[model samples]
Target chain A: MDKKRKYPYFIENPLEHDRVRRFLDIFSAILETSNYRYILDLYSRVTMKCSRCASECQIYQATNDPKDIPCHRTSILLKIYKRHFTLGGWLKAKFTGGSGLTEKDIDEMLESYWNCTGCGRCVLYCPLGIDHRIILRLGRYILSEMGIVPKNLLVSTREQLQGETHNSSKVPLKALQNTVEFLEEEIEEIKGVKVKYPIDVYDAEYIFFTPVSDYLVEPDTLMGIACVLHEANISWTIGGTNCDGVNYGLFYSDSILGDVNRSLISELRRLRAKKILIGECGHAYRAIKDFLPTYNDGEKIEVVSIMELTLQLIEEGKIQLDKNVIKEKITYHDPCNIVRQNRGIEEPRKIIRSFINDFVELKSHGQYGLCCGGGGGTVAVDETNPYRMNVAGKMKAEEIKASGADIIITPCANCKKQIGELIQFNKLPMRHAGLHDLIFEAIIMKDGKKHGTDD
Target chain B: MAQMIDFFMKPFFIFSVSVMILGLLRLFIKTIIEIRRVIKTAGDKDFKYTKIFMATLSWIIPGKNTVNTAVVYSIVSFVFHIGLILVPVFLMEHIIIWKGAFGFGWPALGKQAADVLTVITILSGIILLGYRLFSKQRRKLSSVHDYLFLILILVIFISGYFLPKTYSPFNVQVNMLIHIVCGNLILIILPFTRLAHCILYPLLRLASAVAWHFPPNAGKELNKLLYGEENKKI
Candidate 1:
């Protein structure tokens, strides 16, 4: 095979081609002049070279490859920084003329940076507290700008940004409304109660934002959320436009992330919603609750997680649960963005314990929980599944299998899809559930009827 | 040759001092300014000084956190760093040199204690170097500067250790010159190389968001900026 064709994920010998080189030069200049000052400071710091992060990285632990170590993985980009950005690097280039990045170096970065799930477990153990995940994100931004992103992420993000539906799945408002109506009818038939999956209700207190996939892939969580809101009598509505809370730019591109987030804010403003109630999608929750406030200042809308709402409702006695509905040994998978990144660690577990009698804890749980191997958009990228399973997901699978749990509950949509697939691929006995799914099962609705009873 | 060595001694000492002070000042001012600018525009105004102090202190002390995960390497590194500081600050010979140069000196460590510390420092440097070379993981991350810095420190220690004894294998004056030059070179490059960690570690703890644990509002600001929260309207 030609060396040019070796690394298909990245553009070949970027500096060798005029168009690619121009893009690199322009992007490099942008980074040099833009909001990347903090990142530049971070990369310029001396790596203590302790290899402390290797033991903490699941990828390195599984592969035993030094190159997979987070610091080593990041050092590839640091080397580029040193060669292009620093004074010593400049002097070395002046004297030796041997410090410029080559095509081979670009290829290596593409291979290493994408292999990481941006799970950020390494940040916990690093003595200097380097966030290697940011470097991976920066790498993704640069790569995405060069049109070298994974096919799935590129397609989804593009569709979400520029498509007619303004969602990655391209589910139109009609389809979304139809799905919500279907769930409403299904819930009514099962529980002998009528609930509204309200769409674009003006002046609602809460504007509910969730991934479009919730309307297609799994609606159990959606129904659970509807039941909780109905019982609590909260005025919430999903917007007709920009209902997607997912900002894929969180995974790959800053521009896309900004555009997607801004659009969501516009929708919220249009609906005249007072607060943004993000559903049980981890990255979506993070993008809205954490990233939204930063991106859209002066938008005084208070954004919060659904767990906070459910927990608050349960505490107020507005939401009641049977508690005995779930009897199997169940474990919870803490989504990286929620637990470590957003501090939703306890709330999700609290909601689960309300319904589950036999809750088994995975050995690695909470802030240090192993990633579901599908974080940072890896779940969306099909090109890396073999690596995700055999390497990134290995420790997580072993942890799940060892817990001997019959069901695993995760609040994050990405984790739901990733862990569900992992169970199928690894042949584990456990099935995956959303926290809302279990909550849907156990929560006592106000109409004095259980699910599956025809009126 | 002795005259030449004596002639260069004053200038070399002055040069090393100037380089060390100026280089460190530049690094410190730049880092502080950058941090302040970032915080003013994008980060939380309130900083948890106590948290920063504790986090820096925890990392400075030996056997706190590193002991749990990296036992052997942490122990060796801690011993080496402790000895490296103790010998330089307390050794009688170094104090005597300081007294001669600056007319100020402190009480020095006993000769026997200095000897033991010197040996420990030398051994630790060797062990650390060996670890870097032999451990495939570390070796992959190791660069030319890593090895060169280790070699420089070892030479400084080795030459200083023999400077007190009547060694005949090589010219004593030459050995003295090698020790002086290597030590001076280290001072000149200290701010430029990974050795800057010796000074910047604590500052990074205070200034960098990753290293600080702040109040809730501060955390929100930090999350907004570092996590792309500030890019949107709050």
Candidate 2:
């Protein structure tokens, strides 16, 4: 029998002190006086009672504790703001429930803030219309500055930043080159084409950034991009360095998280792509769609999600998709980061509908979509805490079962992995497919012949 | 009679009115300035319409929704506000006083309608207060200050409804005076409490609309800023 597993609560870990300190330092630096004041003012004005916000919070509902409410989490940061900044706080801190900050406060803040996946469901329901998730991010930023980040996540983020890829596999240039060569050969053998996987092509109109999974386990998704780009006859190239777009740094704090994005942006400028297309990764899309604009100082390079681009190509008659390419009855899982956080519900559906004839919809598809439970770098850590993962994935698993679709197609790499694990754990019949795989299968070649074989 | 008249003629009344007007004017100016800032920051053209529509609707909608579920409470609250406005300005007694003070006399709604509105407003206010205590979601969000304000409103509304007639041994004139004073106090506190949402809601909606449109991204050199480093990687 498999050994009983323990939940990997960061507080319970032996290396908690070192991890906590590092997180605290990073968090403090980011929440310097100016940023703190600005965030405090935003939080102050955003406090309002809305039942809609309460209705949307799954964690709060699951726990049945108002403390678990997103607004209550916001209140933790708001209390600090009250104590340090607000005038009302100066007059009656006790009455307002504001008090002197302590180490215990820091510990609780770390635990609660990290618990949130930053899915942004509350932003949809806020009546006064606050992005509670952004406030939580600010809390994460402060925590990260203090060196209080969770160990497993922090280690992965450090590796990704240092190695330029999240996987311990540490895909180097040689591996990447070999993988591309292998993909090219596979396509030639499978689809009868000698198409090139251009590396560092100068001044391409599009610079495609994808998660490392596509290069390793899911070559078909990359080939799908290749097939679509070929059919559209679009000028695009992949970067030789920092080719992986998935940014785990975003899960930690903005400053650390921002480096990967900044690098991607700077690379896009050098290549001079009219548009930068992000691959089928949820957090990568969220970073680009939501966070990138905030940091952007006036750079206007169009950054489009691959699903969005696929839809655009279909609309412009650049690619004709064969519906029968994916014969299995399929349902789409809208990754929380992409759907709720980025508000990218329609484009992916359009792409799916265009490519597959029997595409079914999950009940919680758009703003209400369940998290794959592996977001915010949960998938990367060893599955030491299986119960947390299972409990988190409960909603998603139930929805998948209810859908009765033979295949679950998610445009996000993280979602694909999480759902795959969930399916395996539950002994479900559903198999997982990336959105790009279907797109690849359906693409008609330049010679008016379908690229992918039925097998 | 002479002493009572002197009490009625005290400068406190004039001071209160002046202060209220000043506060209203200050709030109006501040609201306008903030709205302009939002409009200026709005990046997209679509936000312009959204801001305008939200600002307009905030004033038009009264009592959270049109069909008030808490009927008695809604009636009481609505009446209290209408009475607070009408009894001070349009009632024959106030009109005479106003004409003496400012040489202006305006058309007034009939006493029956005025009475009905006042009762409805006061009743609604009370029901809402009760709802706040009983409702789970509302109770969760409510702080002590929220409960205090609700009780305060309940007192003012209930007192205004029963003054000089049902429960008070005080003279009708004295009771009415007490009701007016307490009602005004509530108004003064309105700006500081959750009641301030009335004024802040439209402004916030406008800001959201503008922020949504102008999204710090439109028309700027996003490509250059985003892709500058990517070229090196390429």
Candidate 3:
């Protein structure tokens, strides 16, 4: 119980009494009432046992277990859906005594669904285009309904939605003010420029939200973001009232995903901002951008990744880079969430290639890249760090090593954290950073001072 | 047996083929309704159907963007599907039956090509089944239905191949009965079983696009239903 005290969870509450019954009840309700039924119904019927997804799954490659096979793992739930919900399955069960949901299936699900990472590479290779990632998420969402979730993710989600501070990391508004002040001074000292992280400026063209943890731990990324935005003269503010963009809901529950976005969008509405900019968080960006189409009728504000904004600024000649600041060999790690969504892929690569002189690509990059193993809320689990490094993250780690790059520029907070863990545990000499972290180094002021040798 | 085959063939084909067409139509209509409901309920209906259409084509075509290891299997599946559909519709015997019944028929495959296609269909169908039975991973995912379905298709193809010959171990009538009966059974089960994938595959893609989507306030509604109040966290 003496784990990360930053987050709190009611793990014991889910398994309190008659859990199997509760699980089945929730599962049945979710299937019937929730929108997942259509997908589950369709995928359950069409999903093949061909093991095609195995070729693309990093988890399967490492463990070489049949259970690790994406389709096989997905089949576990699909079989249950058929056995319990569909007419054919019901007939078969009545005649043949087919199995139903049980404690053993629950145990396997608890282990398998969480470990999936939901990187979604396998979905692309699915012959039927059955993105089992969604199905796995459906499984997790059902488990979440039973209150079965990783403690850290649930705690963080709880805090974001209802904690003392309106952020996942539980950082108070006072701390954000202090971090901004500290970064303001740090920017003046480091870049010889006066950059401000404007707060609560209503009617600004853009409002920015980054992972609250990055606000505290990744000061360099914040500084790069601040300096770039300041130089670009883009009207933006960080809403101290609701300052985090990390949505763990996207990994587990649709309802939570919607609820969290509703809260964020409310902040945007409150500010009366025309556009919302997300910083260095793929799922957060996806939560707002991709999920918005399904959440609303595309009526409201525009959502853009900081990478997209930065790429635009670079193209418009609003931001200048020194290109020589990054001498180390560099590769970009495409976060599964960003690339899979197909929105944030090209921007980060373009931005990295613009200034990174010694840039290299991973063995598999773009939409086909391996996962950092911290996807699907796995990084928040913490106890599974070893497994992530060895099995889940192994393919990405090996690819990074083989790329022989000294630095891996990860554009998403989750990938940065997960790949950081991969490097730490794998004992790889290389380090990883957000694209903005390098942007902080290579950014030269437009029509202002260069990072001159005199300093 | 000849009398039975004659008596049943016309009505059986009519009934089963009608069921197949209407069943797939029902599935299609249901899919569109579900997609619209999910979107309309969510309040976000701005999906790019054009892009989805293009993407559907990519994966629907075997060997396009396939994983290196799955290339052979995908190609084999492609071949099996081609022969499965082509031989049934284009065989001279089938066209002759169609002409006899409807008083008109389209072009038919030459005997040599039809024989070759039938032989390949049976062979590839076996390989596909072999793939499922051989791998522990695949076998674990397989069900009795999976095995039975492939075996059923192989039976149809093998019997169809023997039907064209003048002589066989059990005579051509035995193969004729199997080809007719097995083909009818497939048509009957096509929509009920995973065999529906032949038509449902594209809708499977659209379902994936639209299905996991959340209706606005989806979480709030579920929470209130379960606990009488939406919690701070789900």
Candidate 4:
């Protein structure tokens, strides 16, 4: 039999200090220090609890568990806020059996908040414009402060923030250099020309940061990025230490999110790059693009996502694609961070459509697109694979199955991983890849020098 | 007894309405102060006023841009709000009361239309209360306050509906007093409870806009405050 599990099976809480008191203190500190209280104050009042979000929540839909309902999950925190923070709730509980913050409630949040992919699809359905993910993040942030973070997330973030390699993945300077050279070689083999993979080239126009995992696992994406940048004449550089764009901080801690983005921006300012160019990761783009300004000293350091840049390059006729290069029917998966938050709805689709004849749309596309379920850093947590594959992953799996496409092209690294996992778990026939992965396959090499011309 | 009831009606009505408006004003002022605070402190200060305004409008009128994802409840809730606001302010007798007290009244709603709206409000309130009560999901999120507020509104509506009917068990003065007092009671407590959603709902999106705008070095500040100098804790 599997060993009887202890409490907090989801995240690693050291239990060294008083967890309950730490939770309340952190919760109080957040309200006192930031504008977070304003949102909570308004949110605690405006929530209608109509169960409208249930119809849209994929996890809730698959599990058929009310606990999975975004409103219900959000209420776990909102209830605590009402009881402890607000006057009405305090009076009610004082007189009529109201309760305080409990260890059990924290456990419920530990279990529930991560279950959401932070999709914000439910925001579209909600009449009040309440983004459940914002509440979800607040819940996750408080828990992380209480030292109740998924070991996978906490470990990786700890490694990135404190370790010698200075990245979530412990890719050393030598390994990053090796990854760059490897991508250069792959680009040369694929395009019959040397694609520019610049490193520490001072005063470059842009600085590139992809998910560090992409450096290890996604050579084609790095190669594709190089080829596109080379063809577009966009000079870019990558810093060694802070090159990782994957911010798992967005999933849990605001401080970590800020620190990660701050580390990247520190690199950009050091390298004197015009803007930070993020590679194919959903939350990475959102973390940097959306939160960087807040995290940094109120300077909206410009961000150009690889997808947006590629689309710009394509739209400007700087680089062209040969549609005949790809034969499979392809469908696009809109990463929630990209579509719902960043409003990057059609940039990838427009790029894909320009290059493929058999481009298919899923049953629900764009802002209404479902989550890959492996979001919120759930992909990193080894214990959640079953939940990611079965509960949250099923809707997206069914969508891909229904689309009848041979390949799914999502520009998000997280979505690609989740979709990859879904296919393996469900024994599906289709393939999943990043948008850049397809671009590398289909991008016409420089000026009629075909991939095989010099081979 | 008539003079005492009249005295109770005028003074209590004036007091409740004043408290309701001032309370809402105070909260709204807090929201504005929050906006200014976020401007000074938050990361991104750009406010998408057009998008927020349009989105707010869509929710205000369900036939607009809400896109009907929660088709049944939203539409029902919209119908519910219609009479919940309109019938009290626009009904002829209510206007007559206002005119009697304040020496001015606007055009009153037709009696037939007012009754129709009143019944619709009561029915939809029942549906909403049922929606809250029956769903185990909803019940878990609800408070006794939520239940009591709904029942209070229902009481006021039921009493208002029965006010004109002479076949009632209670005398006319008794029925009128119940309607008057319950209406004032809701107004008095409106800002303190979730019912303050009435004033805060339209301005809701702005709070989110402000929340995402974090103060400069907020993370570091919070961590330092929580865990001493170094990033020692977690």
Evaluate fnat for each of the predicted models and list the values in order: 0.25, 0.10, 0.72, 0.71
Instruction: Provide per-model DockQ scores.
Output: 0.25, 0.16, 0.63, 0.62
Model 3 lDDT, residue B122, Cα: 87
Q: What is candidate 3's lDDT per residue for A243-273, written digit by digit as tens?
A: 7888887888877787778778888888888
Q: Which 10-residue span in candidate 4 chain A carries the lowest summed lDDT?
A: A1-10
TM-score of each: 0.89, 0.78, 0.95, 0.95
Comparing 2 and 3 on TM-score, the stronger one? 3
DockQ of 2: 0.16
**Candidate number with the higher DockQ (2 or 3):** 3
Write candidate 2's Cα lDDT for B1-234 as tens digits: 445433443444445555566665555466667556544543323334654565346434563431222344334444455555564456554465556655677887677665565576566556666656786766786677766766665565555555534656666666566655665566565555455554555555454433332234221222223333322111
Between candidates 2 and 4, the TM-score winner: 4
Candidate 1 ranges beyond 4 A from true positions:
A1-16, A298-300, A450-455, B1-11, B40-57, B62-64, B90-92, B103-117, B161-176, B205-234
The residue pairs in collision within model 3 are: A255-B219, A296-B43, A296-B44, A297-B43
Please list the C-alpha lDDT of all candidates, in the order they appear: 0.77, 0.63, 0.81, 0.81
Candidate 2 local lDDT, A37-150, one digit each (tens): 443454464465534455557666555666667877887777766665567766677576654566566667766776666677666556455667666767766665444556
